[model samples]
Target: MTQVIRAYVGSLLGFLLLDALWLGFIAKDNYTQAMEGLMRDKVHIWPWIVFYTLYCMAMVYLVIRPQFNAEKASGVFIGGGVLGAAAYGAYNMTNYALLADWPLGISLQDWVWGAVVTSLSSYCGWRLARR
Candidate 1:
């Protein structure tokens, strides 16, 4: 239980930090330009909280726990990368398909970012759990 908690915390923190960098700085201009009129002037706080919480929970349960249990060091990152790719791909592809204004560039960028960020976060979670 303690290990799980530790893993979750580490994963959440890592994810938040990396995502903050991506959304707040690195990809800000791209997102603003891509989203255009669709973005809210003031962001909603609750959705972010809920998303981060649930996403990290899924990461822990589906990726971290199994890797940790199996003592597989590399699987955490690989699994996380795969998971991120799948999740982000689904969302981005859906938007591209449904939304006329959705850009393929944005979807591609997000897929890459998601894979990198989630891979690192999963590694962090595994590290914390191991200790």
Candidate 2:
């Protein structure tokens, strides 16, 4: 529906901007790369960030009815984000299984980091909804 697309697209862009800004303060180096739109090792987090944010915002927006309130959306977004993190963990396991010799360390810790990044992004999406 029109509203669904609006919320989805709006959440994604809003998160992209806010995350970049949020990271700007907490992570100056990453913020620089994000601002420049460069593809560096640091920028690798972007994919996971964007993915989780999109999933949470979209899920919340789609589920809530005609007029989505920020509070309800935030709750749903958090739930969606947690689910996304779990999904990301599973995905990493599958990916590592496919690539036995991944240059980067193939461990549960790495997978956990992926989940952290996803959770953070989802949080950002929720924050944006409230604004």
Candidate 3:
């Protein structure tokens, strides 16, 4: 139970930090240009909180726990990337398909970001849990 909590906290922190960097600095221009008229001036806080909570829980359960149990960092990295890519791809691809103005470049960039972030976070979580 303690290990699970440690891994969850570690992964959540890692995810938040990396996502902040991506949204605030790295991909800000891309997202702004892509979302232009589609974005709200102010994002609602509750939905995002819910999303992060659920997403992190899924990551901890599906990626971090297995890697911790197996004591294999590679499992965490690979599984996390795959899971993240699939999850993000579902959202992005669906938007691209349904929304006329959804940018393909944005979707691609987000997919990459999601996979990389998930892999790194999962590794961090696994390492923290092992300690």
Candidate 4:
């Protein structure tokens, strides 16, 4: 139980920090240009709150816990990256299929970013759980 909590906390913090840096600074202009009219003028807070909460839980439970117990450090990073790819791919592909002008480049970039971010975040979770 305690380990679960630690993993969740660590994963959430790492994910949020890395994502914030990417969205708020690194790729802000790119995303703004890519999303353009699709984006809301004002940020919606609730959806993000819910997404982060549930996503962190899933990351900790599905990726971190099993890998941590198995003592496979590599598994956590690999599994997390795969999970991120699948999740982000689903969302991006869906948008590409449904939306009129979704940018393939942005989707590709997001897929890579998701994998990298989730891999590192999973490492953070595993480290905390192991302690």
lDDT of each: 0.91, 0.51, 0.89, 0.90
Whole-model lDDT, model 1: 0.91
Q: Give candidate 3 regions above 4 Å deviation.
A: none
Model 1 C-alpha RMSD vs. true structure (Å) is 1.2
lDDT of 2 by residue, 37-88 (tens): 3335554767777674656554444433323554554554455446545765
lDDT of 3 by residue, 1-131 (tens): 99998898888889999999999999999999989989998889998788788888888999988777684588899998998999899999999999999999999999998899989988878888888
Please tell me which model should have the higher lDDT, number 2 or number 4: 4
Question: What is the C-alpha lDDT profile of model 1 across 79-124, one tens digit per residue?
Answer: 9999999988898999999998889999999989988898999888
Task: State the displacement of the C-alpha of residue 71, model 2, in Å, after optimal TM-score superposition.
Answer: 3.4
Backbone steric clashes in candidate 4, count: 0
Assess the local accuracy of residue 20 in candidate 3 as a C-alpha lDDT between 0 and 100: 95
Ordered from best to worst lDDT, the candidate numbers read 1, 4, 3, 2
lDDT of 3 at 39: 96
The Cα error of candidate 3 at residue 14, in Å, is: 0.2
Q: Please give the clash total of every predicted structure, in order.
A: 0, 0, 0, 0
Winner of 1 and 4 under TM-score: 4
lDDT, residue 5, candidate 4: 92
